[model samples]
Target: MIPSNKPFFDDTEIEYATASIQSGNIAGDGPFGRKLENKLSDYLECKHALLVNSCTSAIEISLFALGIGPGDEVICPSFGFVSVANAILQCGAKPVFAEIDYETMNLDPAHTEKQITTRTRAIILIHYAGMSCDLVSFSELKEKHGLYLIEDAAQALGSKLQGKALGTFGDSGCFSLHETKNLTCGEGGIFVTNDDNIAQQAEIIREKGTNRSSFLRREVQKYTWVGRGSSYILSDILAAVALAQFEKIEPILSSRTKIAEFYQNAFAPYNYITPPTIPDGCKPNWHLFALRINKLHRDIFLEKLKSKGIGASFHFVPLHSAPYSKTKLKGGNVSLPVTDRVASELIRIPIYPQLSNAEKESVVSSMEEVAEELGLE
Candidate 1:
């Protein structure tokens, strides 16, 4: 079967990881880790980049470093990964769910502005499917309200908007390097920021709320407990693997771009399905290719694809309607019309750098057949 997603890796990752292990520095923030961070900072053009264990950890650390806690409300799109809301809740903050624009599956700037209030401390903007949201409008809102902006750039490592990197626009940005992502280190993440104060605080928070980072630089005679923090650092071994993948980002993104273009062209003839839209001046990494079926049920389409040995799946279930968000966060009855519609109609097909041309043709042909069977075209 053609899998929904596959991470690309080769002997280069193995060699780097083996070297990291042999160097007796498999701990966090080692040489490999530092190198990876430097590479990320340089590529993203951000002042500081801190490696963390997961995107969730990066979000949590960013929240802590930004002084977001109890009594704060963070506005985020309900149609996204549960990790965003969970991280907010973990930091003693309330996650205010907002609607998304059906076109890009990213937060709707107008609707997001409506959710802001006196208690709203920040807005978490997710670059859904590696396509940027309306950063210009969001930046205006940030300036108007004097609020913090955090980017959930988990899928937007190489994506850009108006010539600026997606992760660099916000006060703090988080990225994922999970096995399923475009870049893979098996499991890892990074936190980035341009603010000097936030960077210093993030370092302290990542190092278990101590001054150890300073001590390592010999700026402090001894390290000690400094503030509230946790062990959010990524291991050197994982960093080595991530560095190997980082070196191949251009080729990886190029391969995915070609696959996305193929999908766009292949599905253009069918009026029953709508392919993802790329906004003006927004360059996507093509992390995922999600099609919105207007007539057929998404599940039926997915099952048909599966029966044809083509792996297809649905994306996120809206967080507001999720069990935890409903029962615990009292968001069960939230009315996010676009979020609900997109969640039900959207289906993800296989789009990975490792997907061969033959596999791509097979997937497209199978999808076309399924659409015909469903009387969609």
Candidate 2:
């Protein structure tokens, strides 16, 4: 069977990681870590970025740094990886689930406004499938409500909205270098922002809630516990691997884009299944190739594709329907029809950087055969 995803790397990645071991700085704070941070800051155009152990840690630190805790509510989309909602819940805050536009698969700002209560402190906007959300509308909502907007750019490495980088639009943004993301460190993440105050607090937050970063930089002689925090820093070896990936990001992004275009061109009979659409002024990373097929036969379609040795699968499950959110975050069976419908029907195809042209042809042929057999073509 064709693999669903494959991480791309060269001998460069191996050498960098090995060098970190030889340098005797396998710890969180090391030269390799600093090198990755500098490159990430430059690429994302953020002032101060801190590498972390995972994207979850990045979001958790951003929440704590922004002082979102008990009695706080963070607005977010109902449809996404549960981690985005998990971060707010981790901070002892409520995750107010908002609906999404099925086409864009992101938070609907209009619905978000209705969901926000007086206790709202922040908004976590995820760029679903690396397609930049309606940031202009989301930003307007943030300003009007005086709420802090946090960008969950986990899937959006090179994505931008109206020329501005996706992650930089909010008070704080988090990026994942997970094996599944556009960028990879195997398992790593980054926290980014231009704001000095938040950035300073984040360093403290990621370092076991101390001023250790300042001490490490020799700005302070001694460091002590200053607030509530945990060890969220990434290891130097991981940073080394991540840095090499960042350096060759252009090629990786181009390859992913090329595959996406190929799929678009081949799937031009778009009515059979809906494909992702990039709105005006947005440049998506094409992290995922999600198609909306007939909702009733979604499973049948998936099984057929799987039988054909195509690594096609379904997209995320709606968080609202999940046991945790149904019981805690939502506190009620709040029926989100759009999220429910999309979750049941969205099919994901292979779009990894190394996906070959021959594989693409085979995938398309298999899908067309499936559609014909189902009498839907």
Candidate 3:
């Protein structure tokens, strides 16, 4: 049976973790964590990178650093994880749900304009399935509206757009290194930005609002209270694990892309399904190989795939459908028709870097069989 996703880690990570433990410095921002942050900066072309315990923490801390609080409105797509909205709520800010573009599954600049008000302070753009949103086009809207852009690049560690990394597009961007993400450290995330002041503030916020990180950097001898903050940092052991995975990032990316291409090629012939597409200016990391099946038969299709041991599944249920968003935010308008439709029909095939060529072929064949059985082909 093909699994949905798996980290492509090997012996390199084991040695790194073991050595870090042996050294007795199994704390935050240790050798491996510092090195990992430096390497991520070089890779993402950002001036500062702060490792955290999760992408949610990264975005939350970013909001805290930006001084966002109650009464502030942050425009974000409603079709993604509830965590996006949750982060804003945690900051005591309102998350104004912006519609998404069906073709790219990213925030729709046109719709985003309709939702903005004087309270709007930021625009959070998610790179769905590791595909970069049209940040350049957002450049105009962003500048005109004076709205800060925050890229939710959790699934887009290796993806780029116009030669720049996805997460580096806005004032600050967040990436997840969760167990499910391409670069896994079991569960971790990072925040990257070019602004020195924001970086310093973020460091303070991530360390329980203290000067510990600065002290660890040897910028000072002792650390103490400096600002408002919380503990949002990644442990050294997790950094060691991520460093080993980072070493093989190239191979993992290549393999995932290959599998994505195979799924696209195999499913291209079907008239009833639509495969994922990459806009000309964007390059996707192919974190998940998703397609649209006939919504009417979507459940049966999921059942068939699972029965065949294919491990196929679906992504986020439309945030509007959730109880909180439905009651508090959706306003009972049921306005996001496309988001509902897409959520119903979407299917995620197995996309781990370790997925064998034969397993990929099997998934393709089984998918075609289910489609044919339901007269979808």
Which one is best on TM-score?
Answer: 1
Q: Candidate 1 clashing pairs?
A: none
Runs in model 2 lying further than 4 Å from the true structure: 329-332
Question: What is the per-residue lDDT of model 2 for residues 1-377, given as tens digits with 9 covering 90 to 100?
Answer: 88777888999899999999899989887898988888878877889888999888999988998999999888887788888888888899988788898788888888889988899999898898888888888889989999999999999988887777789999989999999888798999999999999988889888898998888899988999987889999999999999888888888889988998998999887577887878679888888888888887789989999999998898787888888766655453577788888899899998888888899999999889988888885
**Per-residue C-alpha lDDT of model 1 across residues 11-125, encoded as one tens digit per residue:** 9999999999999999888999999899999999999999999999999988999899999999998999989999999999999999999898999999999999999999999
Clashes of each: 0, 0, 0
Between candidates 1 and 2, name the one with more favorable lDDT. Answer: 1
- TM for every model, in the order presented, reads 0.98, 0.98, 0.98
CA lDDT, candidate 1, residue 349: 92
lDDT of each: 0.92, 0.87, 0.87
lDDT of 3 by residue, 1-377 (tens): 78888878788899999999999988888999999999999998999998999999999988999999998999888789777889999999988877888888888889889988999999999999998787877878889999888889998999999888889989889999988898898899999999999899999999999999889878999999999998899999989998898888888889888888888888888898888879677777888887887788888989999999988898778776778776777452348877777788889889988788889889988988887787776
Measured with C-alpha atoms, the lDDT of residue 285 in candidate 3 is: 85
List the candidate 3 regions with Cα displacement exceeding 4 Å: 329-334
